[model samples]
Target chain A: MIYLLLFWEFFKIGLLAVGGGLVTVPFLFDLTEEYSWFDKRELIDMIAIAQSTPGPVGINMATYAGFNAAGIGGALLATLSEVLPAVIIVYYIAKMLKRWQDSPYVEKVLKSIRPAVIALILFAGLDVAKETVVDWQTAAVLVVLCAAMRLYKKSPFFYIAASAVIGLILKI
Target chain B: MVGLWQIYCLFFKMGIFTFGGGYAMLPILQSEVVRKRHYVTEDELLDYYSIGQCTPGIIAVNAASFIGYKLRGLGGLLSATLGVISPSLVIIVLIAMVLRQYMDNQYLQWMFGGIRISVTALIINTVWDMWRKSVVRVRDYIVFAAAFGLMWCCGLSAALIVLLAAGAAFIPDIRRLKK
Candidate 1:
C-alpha cells in the first residue's frame, strides 16, 4: 500500500510538474501537508538537503519523502514514479517532432508556456526567499546576489561561493 | 558491462562534483555528456534542459535519465539514476545519523546559515536568468503574474493552476476551431 501510494504521488508529480524542479516545491508542500509524512521544519531541512545534494531538488525531496514513509524501497519507487511521466512524454514528444517539426501551432503553444514558466520560477524564488531570508542581513545578501546575478554574466556558482564566504565572514 | 560501468562512473563523477544541485549540474553535464562522452549533442542537451525544467524530478537526474535512455535504453536510465544519487544518499545518511544529536550545535547552525544564504543567492540568480530569457511579451507577463498569484496567493494546487493555464491558452484555439 505504501509502495502504491509512493508511486501514485510521484506519478502525479511527474505528470504535472510541467515547469521544472523548483516548481515542484509548492506541490510537495501540499503533499507533505496531506500525508503528514513530514512537517514544515522537516520540509525546510529537506529543502536544505535537496539544495546541497547532487541530484535535482525535486527528486531528492521525493526520495526523502519516500524514505521517511517506507524506507529504501519507497524511495526507489517514488523516484522512479516521479520520472516515469517525463520518460513517457519525452519519448512521444521526440517521435512527434520528426513529423511536426515545422508546425506553427506547436511552436506557438510552446512559446506561450515560456512566460508561465518564468512566473513559476519567480514564485519559487519568492517562496525560497520568504523561508530563508528571515532577517535584514539575509535580505541584504539576497538583494546583493540578485543584483550581481542581473548585472554579471558569470556562472552562478561564483555568486554562491562569494556569498557563502561573505556570510561566514560577517557571521550572519 | 564495461560500458555500463563507464556510464556509471561518468555520472558518479558528476554527482560528486556538482555543489548547488540541479542547475549547478548543467555545465558539468554539458561538458561531460555532450563534449567528452559524445553521448548527446549540444542541441539535445539544451532540449533536455528545457524539458527537464518542465518535468518532475531533479534536472540533473532528469538529464541523466534522458541521456542514459538515449544511450542505453532502460539499463542506461537505471545506471545513471543510481550514479547521480549514490553520493548524496551516502552522505545524507551519514549526516543524518551522526548529526542527529548535534543538529542544534552552534557550528553546524553557523555553517547552515552560510549555506542557506548561498542557496538563496543561487535560486535568485536562476530566477533572474529564466525571467530575462523567457518573459518576452505582455501576455507572457500576464500568464506569469496569474500563475504566481495562483501558486502563492490563492494557495491553489500547482496541478490545477497549470491545467487552468493550459486550458486558458487553448480557449482561443477551441473557439477558432468551432467557428
Candidate 2:
C-alpha cells in the first residue's frame, strides 16, 4: 500500500512539474505538509543535496524522499514513476514532432508559457528565500552566495563547497 | 563509430559534473556532443533543449533521452537515461545513508544551514536570469504579473497555473483562426 501510494504521488509530480526540476519544489512542499514522508526542514536538506549532487534535481530529490519514506525499494519505485511520463510523452512527441514543430498554435502556446514559467521560477526563488534566511547570518550567507554566483559562471559546486567550509569555520 | 557503450560513458562523465541542475549541463553538452563527437549538430541540440523545456521532466534528462532516441532508438534511449542517472543512484543512496546516520551532528547542521542559504541564493539568480529572457513586451509583463498574483494570492495548484496560462495564450490564436 505504501509502495502504491509512493508511485501515485510521484506520478502526479512527474505529470505536472513542467518547465524543469525546480518547479517540483512546490509540489514536494505540499507533500511534506500532508504526509509524514519528511518534514519541512528535511525539505531544505533535500534541496541542498539535490542541487549539490549529480543528475537532475527532480530525480535526486525523488530518490531521497522515497528512500526516507520507505526504503531502497521505494526509491526505485518513485524514481521510475517520476520518469515514466517523460519517457512515454517524449516518445509520442518524437513521432509527431515534425507536424507540431511548425504549428502557429503550438508556437503561441509555448510563447505564452514563458511568462508563466518565469513566474514559477520566481516563485521557486521566493519559496527558498522564505524557508531560509532566519537571521543575520543566514541573510549574509545568501548575499555572499548571490555575489559568488558569477565566479562559477553557472556550475554551483564551487559556491556550495565554499559555503560548507565557511559554515564550519564560523560554527554557524 | 559511436557505440552504445561510448554514449553511456560520455553521458556518465557529464552526469558527475552536472551540478546546479540542467542549465549547468549546456557547456558540457556543447563541448562533448558538439565539439568532440560531432554526432549531434548545434541546431539539434538547441531543439532538444526547447523540446525538453516544453516537456515535463528534468531538462537535462529529457534532452539526453531525446538525443539517445535519435542516435540508437529504444536501446540508446535506455542506455543514455541510465547513464545520466547512474551517478545520482550510486552517490545519493550512499550519501543518504551517511546523512541519516549523522543528520544531527552539530557541525553538519551548521554546514547545512549555510548551504541552504547559498542554495536559496542560487535559485534567486535563476529567477533573475529567467526573467530577462521570459518577460518582454507589455502582454508578457501582464501575464507574468497575473501568474505571479494568481499563485501568491489564490494559492492555485501547478496544473491549474499551467492550464490557465496556456489557455490564455491560445485565445488569440484560436480567435484569429476563427475570423
Candidate 3:
C-alpha cells in the first residue's frame, strides 16, 4: 500500500517538475508534511547528499526519500516512477522534434512556468530556513554560508562538505 | 549504429563521473556524445537541452531519453535513461542504509545539524539565481507574486499553481496567434 502511494506521489512530481532538478524541491517538501516517511531534518540531509552527489539531484532525492520510507523496494519504485514520465514523453517528442520545438504553445507554457517555478523554489528555501535555522549558532552558520555561496560561485558540493567539517569542529 | 550496451555503458560512466548535478553533465555529454562518439551533432545536443528544459521531468533524464531514442529507438531510450539513474539509485540507497544505522548517533546528528544549515543556504542561493534568471519581465514578476501569494496565503499546492501559471502565460500568446 505504501509502495503504491509512493509511486503515485513521485509520478505526480515527475509529471509536473519542469525547468530542472531544483524545481522538485518544493514537491518533496510537500511530501514531508503529507507523510511521515521522512521528516524535514532528514529532508535537509537528503538535499545535501543529493546536491553533492553525481547524477541528477532530483533522482537522488527520489531514491533517498523512498529508501527512508520503505527501504530498498521503496527506493526502486520511487525512482522508476519518477523517470517514467520522461521516458514516455521523450519517446514521442523525439520523433517530431521540429514540430514540437516550433510550437508556440510549448513556448508559452515554458515562459509561464519559469516564474512560477522560481516562486516555488523561493518558497521552498524559506520553508527549509524555518525548519533548520533555530538558534543563534545555526543562524550564524546560515548567514556565513549564504554570504560565501554568493561571493564565491562554487559548486554546492563544496559548501555541503565544508559545513560538515565545521559542524564537527564547532560541535554545534 | 551504437550498440545498446555501449550506450548504456557510456551513460553509466557519465552517471558516476559527472558531479554537481544536471547542468554539470552537459560538458561531459558534449565531449563524449558529440566529440568522441559522434552520437549527435553539437546543434542537436543544444536542441535536446532546450527540449529537456521544457519537458516535465529531470533535464538529465529527458536529454538522455532523447539521445537514446535517436540512437537506437526504444531500447536505447530505456538503456540511456536507466544508465543515467542507475548510479544515483545505488549510491543514495547505500548512503540512506548506512545513515539509518546511525539514526541515533550523537556525532552524526551534530554533523547533520551543520549540514542542515548549509542546505538552507544552498536553497536560498538557488532561489536567488532562479529569480535573477527567470524574473526579467514585468509579466513574469506578476506571475511570481501571484504564485507566491497563492501558496503562502491561500495554501494552494505547488502543482496547482504551476498549472494556473502555465494557463495564464498562454493567454497572451493565444490572443496574438488568433490575430
On lDDT, the candidate that comes out on top is 3
RMSD in Å for all candidates: 6.0, 5.9, 7.4
lDDT of 2 by residue, A1-172 (tens): 9999999999988887776667788999999878899998999989877875667788888888898899888888888888778888886776675468578887676677667766765675677577777778778878877876755564555666687788788777
Screening candidate 3 with a backbone cut-off below 3 angstroms (N, C-alpha, C), the clashing residue pairs are: none
User: Candidate 1 on B105-179: residue-level lDDT in tens?
Assistant: 665556556656656666556556556766676666777788887777688754455555555555455445788
Q: How far out, in Å, is residue A100 in model 2?
A: 2.1
Candidate 1 regions off by >4 Å?
Answer: A1-58, A61-101, B1-60, B63-80, B97-103, B167-179
Error of 3 at A9 (Å): 11
For model 2, the interface Cα RMSD in angstroms equals 4.6
Off by over 4 Å in 2: A1-78, A150-154, B1-80, B95-99, B171-179
Model 3 scores a C-alpha lDDT of 0.79
Name the weakest run of 10 consecutive residues (lDDT summed) in model 1 chain B. B166-175
Candidate 3 residue spans exceeding 4 A from truth: A1-82, A93-98, B1-84, B91-99, B171-179
Estimate the overall C-alpha local distance difference test score of candidate 2. 0.74
A89: Cα error in model 3, Å: 3.6
Which structure is stronger by TM-score: 1 or 2?
2
The 0-to-1 C-alpha lDDT of every candidate, in the order given, reads 0.66, 0.74, 0.79
Ranking by TM-score: 2, 1, 3
What DockQ number belongs to candidate 3? 0.44
